[model samples]
Target: MVTLVYLSVIILAWFATAANADIQVVCANKSVSITWEISADLVPYAARLFLGSCMPSHLNLLPSGKGEVQFNYGFENCKFKKQIKGKQMSYQNEITFRPYPKSKPAAFVYPIKCVYRSPANLNNQFLNPGSVSEGRGSLVFHMALLNEQLTGLATTNVIPLGSFMPIWAQVEQKSHQPLLLLMEECVAAHTPQLHSGSWVYPIINNKGCLLESKQGNSIFLPRYHSSALILYLQSFRLGHEGEVYIHCKLTAWDPDVLDESNKVCHYVKETERWSLLDDPFQSSICNCCDSTCKSRSKRQAEQESRGLRHNFVLGPLIVVEPDSPAK
Candidate 1:
């Protein structure tokens, strides 16, 4: 009877210690720091603790017999994953520890994340005079093909055929009212200039719907802001060789108003239905994705008069097969 009571006491103490573990994270412009305070009972297993495949950089034993571990890494290190969502860039990693040496899975896991404002300037060297449209008292629009991190333009023009390509488009609202950016239509072409003889593949069509998403994993990611959008397109081979260019018609519209003509939609494979990325409640606007999506005559004229629409091109991207050598 005494042995059973002692065993219960030990079990309760272990649970209490595990519940007291705490973690804190600090994010900076280019680096991140994570500090974890481990309970005294778990200090013996500290060697097995990891933060996203990275062992703690510094560990200190406290007077209370507890352990404090610190993890310091740059934004690009420690296997930290980056995500852009609603004007914020989030860096995510996990704190995990295995209670036993042979454990196949982590016995304890705590997710840690830090968020910062998305960089204002992506520093795209590809932006040319033609890419910007600034009518007197009108919004300025910019578009570029972003790198995998969404931090800047792709460093290289070569991409694996099946890999995801990131395209970012944003609007500099200036003094104008809040506006949302939308890709009305996008196409992949063999040449920078579109001629009658050019080979073209449609991506986003039917006004603002992502057509490739119906057949592929391509889709519009969540917006960094109402004024900024990112499209993750699965690369495809365009005629086996040279550079592929992406041409898109971008539109800026009132954020409060979303119509069949001014919205972003993508097909979700799981639900087998088209979904609106910005506002799902009004996803009914996406039903037109299957058929013709006509623009409101009056709205079209207004957009044209206000110079709220423009065309942008991004590319020279080379798509190669899985085993092909990098260019």
Candidate 2:
């Protein structure tokens, strides 16, 4: 890597002259490299080549769920880099530039992005306290402990045989007793055609007495897990007013150091169903589009041919529930 960088320096120092040729490209995984590619005649001046690196543009993920991203390989200002050795001229036959920042760690920051919120958007199908039956659909929840000492990790709580499962699997096994559920809805004022900007976080709506569960406790008695959650959001919108869509977006990272090779690390498991902390398309996000960051015409057609991706899309995954719970 040092050799390529040094060689790039030589190319920039003595030989290359800034010409009319358009020059630029957006390399993946941060880091933009800009170098002037000169014809064979400028080889001697290429010895003076110097490289200038731009400060990387940093992007953060939104929400607090855990995730991991590894920077594989990337380079900026690639089209103009010259690779040669001892006057051994390689070809316009093909150009191969060295990939950089091989295996290095980044800071302890999470890859979180901010979700944009707009007051004018809402989902028409949603309802509230003033609406019809179903009691306006309230949510009551608690983290219950069956036999606090009878851990899901242990055998006494099971049927003698054992396999693999999460520490919270017991909560799922005994779906009765003290139950936990979270409810949320989105609303818009005049959500015309629901143009990708209609969504909201899961709001709280508790009813009756709430249930509570904690670790290292006894199972016979349940705690009064308390919350004053209700759906009196006058600003909330209805779901069915326009088109409704749910897309996924995750931002995860820890305090661990990231190396160049550290592409994915310390991912926060999608263990619990985390409520939405932010909506995906409240503002413009770079979902997909051909970028004009390059000067070459070859890449132009590639950017223009984007399909529906030109419009913002929630990440490709989401959990779906029915209008009413199972009858």
lDDT of 2 at 273: 14
Candidate 2 per-residue lDDT over residues 1-327, each given as its tens digit: 897776566445422333342234333222333333334433333322222211222222324431111121122121112212222211111122222242532211111111212111111111222211111112211121122232222222221111211111111112223222212111223322344564543221111110110111101111111010111111112343322222111111111311111111110112111111111111011111112111213432342242100111211111123232321
Question: Model 2, poorest ten-residue lDDT window?
Answer: 207-216
Candidates in order, TM-scores: namely 0.61, 0.16
Against the true structure, what is every candidate's RMSD? Answer: 9.7, 24.2
Candidate 1, residues 1-327, lDDT tens digits: the string is 895575445446655665666778887766688889876765665777887756888989999998898988764445566555656867677888754454477666788788878555542343455343344346677876677977666767788888999887887877887778889999999888998887799999988999999989997874556788889999998776657899998888888778898889888774577777766556789999999887767857776677888888887888888788987
lDDT of 1 at 72: 84
Model 2, backbone clash pairs (residues 3+ apart or across chains), number: 53
Residue 189 in model 2: shift from native, Å?
35
Model 2, which residues run further than 4 Å from truth?
1-7, 10-99, 103-120, 123-125, 128-327
Residue 319's lDDT within candidate 1 is 88
Evaluate all candidate structures by whole-model CA lDDT and list the values in order: 0.76, 0.21
Error of 1 at 262 (Å): 0.7
